[model samples]
Target chain A: MIAHKESGERIDPTGIKIGMWLFLYSEIILFGGLFVLYAAYFHRYSESFAAGGEELDRLIGAANTVVLLISSFTVAASITALRLHQRRRCICLLLFSLLCGVIFLVNKYFEWGAKFARDLYPGSETLVGGEPGLNIFFGLYYIITGLHGIHVLIGMVLLTVSLVWVVSGRATAERYSMLDNSGLYWHLVDLIWIFVFPLFYLVL
Target chain B: MSNQSLEQQQQEHLLGYRQLAVVLCLLLLLTVVTVAVSYVDLGFFNVPVALAIACGKVSLVLLFFMHLKYEGAIINISFLSTVLFLVIMIGFTFWDVAFR
Candidate 1:
């Protein structure tokens, strides 16, 4: 029953928090489907999966891991800044997080580009002489990583929008639910990367 | 609206920074452990070890960085349900793929 002095707005923070949680739940399901697909194909092509995974540059993956971990920390700090009502610091941290996301996508671009140059675009194109295991492995690789890259792209856009809100004064310390929710979403993006890094790059 | 200064509010909020730093350090340690353990020829234990470390890191992030520890039970329940549902889906898919 707290009232806003300026516009006389009454807010229920709990409701919005729950709404974000629900949204996150749906996202988990979406990613879960892709994970299942990956697991199925991995089981089918254990050796090829390992071999194809070796083709991936571990250094790049590891660098991206550091990048994302740093971004996650920045986003966490941003949320703390928001709660502390430090508007400038919050905005700066959010911008830094978004920049990190862009760097991740750039890395992904090079990784996928290398695969494409090798004529590894999944499906029949992925197999040179009908190696079923390689075919299956590449197929799952494209599907899972492709979908994940798209999600990261979306997250970048979400973070950019939040940054814009902060710049425009639409998001403030007292009414920063949007920023908080977006931070959660960004953290999830980073978390997914944490799993993806090990699964795709280090498992071999 | 009574009287607390903005600086005081900011300082109070930063009180958790030390705890966050500790968790971050732990996460880094776990990451190193996961990578180092991966090099060992433990057969099936390799993936399990990596996954265990990953789970531990995730727990730290959720409980500390995300402030889930201080949040209401509703948030915890919601997150748990999400994880549970994901497990069920993954299990079903595993069964279908393994048997077929």
Candidate 2:
């Protein structure tokens, strides 16, 4: 506890984690609100939801799932690197995780691009004239996955900042809560995708 | 008696790279299994089955990757309550939809 003192007192890692968990709770509830909509629509329109889901490329979805899962691994391992006093390994691993994030967003870009090309967007001419259930299904799909994609981008920034700190020695073994917290945030992104993958791509 | 060193606190629960690699492999395998199972048409059991596997993966990430397993009860209690309330909220919403 020789470092990271505030007002002559050592800052508590547990307290910072608690604050992060509280934010995560709010995040859970935020997504829960969307899940509730999904539940209602899923109950009333299983057929259309299935149809909309069928339009999704499970191979791509599965690929992104693998990508995020690997990113989660690299991010976690980066923390392990930090703990072992392997600063260069930590930086390399975080860079690898950021690469995965870019890969994810690129995949998402193409996926959404294909959809937009087909006018599969909300209130678009093609989708608007289709079954109301399909419309609702894609609506929820875009919103949920769109929001999760944003989180992925946010996570990349967090990891990048942490990477800078680690490189500059601001985030060291003695005081590396930023790296730990960034890892936690990254895992939460992975956690949400664990649900998102199946609900949209698998359960068709 | 109350002055446990920060180094000791952190080092006590640090995970090895081997453990992280194992968890990663298991998660990837479960992803494969879940995708494979989806093609089998498990009827009404499909969603629940997929979700159960996802839950297993989530637990591994939380316990190992997030280090919740080594954390104190305050953090555990807070995190668990979030999941608990999420379940309650989703359960009640489904209940209302079911009977209404």
Candidate 3:
């Protein structure tokens, strides 16, 4: 319950952390709904879904998994650094995490671009046309991955804001609740990928 | 607490950092195991094996990296409830779809 000298703002770091946890719960449900839909359809077309999943490039998925996992580690390390009052080290780790996030998005861009070029996208315009089940599987695939990508984008922005907070001295060892919360968000992004990796790559 | 108490905080911070690194190494090991296991033709057990490994990795991250293990029980309860509700929702959906 420390008070800021200049602004007299009572910094309740625990409250902010809890708020972020609650928000994370909501996000879980949001994505949980999409997962339910995917599972439902997947049950109906298990073979088609497996076939569609096999069509995906495992190397790219593996690389992206490695990238996101590294980013998660960097962000976690940044939180530890911030807690230690090592502001410079914290900022460096945050920057590294952010760079990893960018690499993930770049990989995703190329992956999606290749899929688009091959017309593997959902809807009637799919390249592998005439197969109803495959089309449905691809439809769910796009929706789920698209939503996960949006979450990654949001996580990147949150990390950027945290980076600014560090540079501006708004965040410090005693006042870095924002960095902790952003770390949680970044971990969620990674968690989603954990599920995605198996569903789209290994399950085939 | 005085701002000058930064030194004490630094020690605790190092402890946290070391714990995080240990957990990260474990995670990497688990990931490697998961990939290796997937290559084997375990048939029906494949999904379960992958998911079991994933759950272990997630538990490590949640407990150590996210500090949920040291946090108050209330936070754990809150997270658990959310997971329970999610399970119920998914179960209901499955029952409805499968039965129909």
- The fraction of reference interface contacts (C-alpha pairs within 8 A across chains A and B) present in each candidate is 0.44, 0.71, 0.35
lDDT of 2 by residue, A9-128 (tens): 677777777889889889989998898889888999999999998999999999999999999999999998998899999999999999999999999999999999989998899788
Each prediction's DockQ against the real complex: 0.40, 0.68, 0.39
Of the true interface contacts, the fraction found in model 2 is 0.71
- The lDDT per prediction is 0.76, 0.90, 0.81
Give a tens-digit lDDT track for model 3, residues B8-100.
443234346667777778887878787778678798787778878888877877877677776656678999999899999988999999999
Top TM-score prediction, candidate number: 2
Q: For all the candidates, what are their Cα RMSDs to the real structure?
A: 3.8, 2.0, 3.5
lDDT of 1 by residue, A16-127 (tens): 8789889888977887787787788778777887887787887888788778777877877886777687878988888888888889889989988998898877644558
Error of 3 at B1 (Å): 13
Spell out the clash pairs found in candidate 1: none
**Alpha carbon lDDT of residue A142, candidate 2?**
98
Instruction: Answer with 1 or 2, whichever has the higher TM-score.
Output: 2
lDDT top scorer: 2
Kindly list the per-residue Cα lDDT of model 2 for residues B21-66, writing each as its tens digit.
Answer: 9999999999999999989998999889999999999999899998
